[model samples]
Structures are given as C-alpha cells and as structure tokens.
Target: MPKLTLDDLAKIREKTKRLTTIRVGGEYRAKVCVHMGTCGIAAGARTIMNALMKELEEREIHDVLLTNSGCAGLCSREPMATVEVAGQAPVKYVDLTEKKIKEIFEKHVLGGKIVQEYALGIGSEKTDY
Candidate 1:
C-alpha cells in the first residue's frame, strides 16, 4: 500500500463520518435513507440521492444522516426514501423525483413537517431505535 497523503486522509475521514453518523443516536436531527435496489436505480434513485446531497451541501446541513438501503419491498414504488426525524415516526415517500425529494428534504427533513402529498405513509415496521 502506498503512503496516504493528507488529502487522502481527509477523504477517508469524511467517508468515515458519513458511514458512522447513523450510529451516533440522538446526535443527528434527521435520517434520510434512499432505497438503492436494482429497481430503484433503474427508476432514478441515484438522482434523488444526489439532489438530497446537493441540498445538504448547499445548506451546510450536517445534522441530517443521509444513507442508502436495499429494496423497500415495493418495486412499483422504485425510487423511495424514508425520512425519520428525531422523536417522530419515519415517513416513507414513494414514486420520488429529484424535484419532489428536494422539497421533502426542505420541508420534512429540515422543517420537521411531513409532506403528506408525497408520502406513502407515516411510521415504519417495528425496529429498535
């Protein structure tokens, strides 16, 4: 292995931080999980994820954990995401577009209000918090 430069270390640090953010319970204000399964990608999940990332970067928002998971089990709703705000139930939004997701990030993720128009449902399957 080659010696890691300072720039390489910085990149590693950022990647680590992104990966570990979800584990630091109560530290983050919200969590956005984009479903990136094969169907999801074909339906444009990548675009949705990228738009969310751009929103976060432009807003300099650090308290929201952005991540991805496998199929949401509803391939018909391929490009889906779940947004969970602290102390609130997670809302699963389906049939997402980049434009709609950016609105969700702004209203639901940042403003703490569910965007009912785009949401499939509120609350998720039982999971240990």
Candidate 2:
C-alpha cells in the first residue's frame, strides 16, 4: 500500500472538512434528509437517496446539504424525506420513489416551492420549551 504524501493528506483533510460542514448545517441554502431506517430501506430509501445525489451532481448544485436519519415514526410511509430550505419551514415528504424524489429536488430544493402533492406535512413538531 502506498503511503499518503503530505499533499494527499492535506487534500483529504480539506475534503473531510467540507463534508463535515455540510453535515453540520453550515452555510447551506437547502437541506435534504432521507430516512434510512430498516423500514425505509425496505421501501427503497436507498434508491431515493441515490436519485437525489444524482440530481445534485448533474445540476452541479452546491450549498445543499444531504443527510439521513432513522424512522420518522411512520413505518407505512417508509421511503420518506425532509426538505428544508433556509428561512423556510421543513417539509416532510412521504412514500417517495426515485421519480418523486427527483421532482421534489427540482421543485422544492431548487425552485423554492413546496411540492405539496408529495409532502406529508410542513414544519417540525412544536417543542414545549
């Protein structure tokens, strides 16, 4: 195995930092969270995630954070995702497929309009605090 040179290490560190920033909700314009729990995977969450990734790459879209979380307590709506654009409330989209996810990305993430047809709800649960 070839040892990494100093330059290679620096590059790796930079890449890692960039990704960490995105995951930690850095100055991103939008955020997509795909539910990847067991039920979600069974219902094709992986495919949904891949489709979103492909869209981001094809459009060369930066400033959008992609992430995953566990089941959203709606097992029936297995393949679910949440799209949150900065300054707007988060929208939970349910029963998603690759096609639906792609459309959601274009309309909601990029176009800044909620795709109401596929959206389960808007905004997170209210906290007592």
lDDT of 1 at 104: 92
TM-score of model number 2:
0.78
RMSD of candidates 1 onward, in order: 6.1, 5.2
lDDT of each: 0.89, 0.87
Give the top-scoring candidate (lDDT).
1
lDDT of 1 at 21: 66
Relative to the unseen true structure, what is the C-alpha lDDT of residue 67 in candidate 2, on a scale of 0 to 100? 85
Instruction: Output the worst ten-in-a-row residue range by lDDT, candidate 2.
Output: 120-129
lDDT of 1: 0.89
Off by over 4 Å in 1: 1-26, 126-129
User: What tens digits encode model 2's per-residue C-alpha lDDT throughout 80-122?
Assistant: 9999999999999998989999889988899999999999988
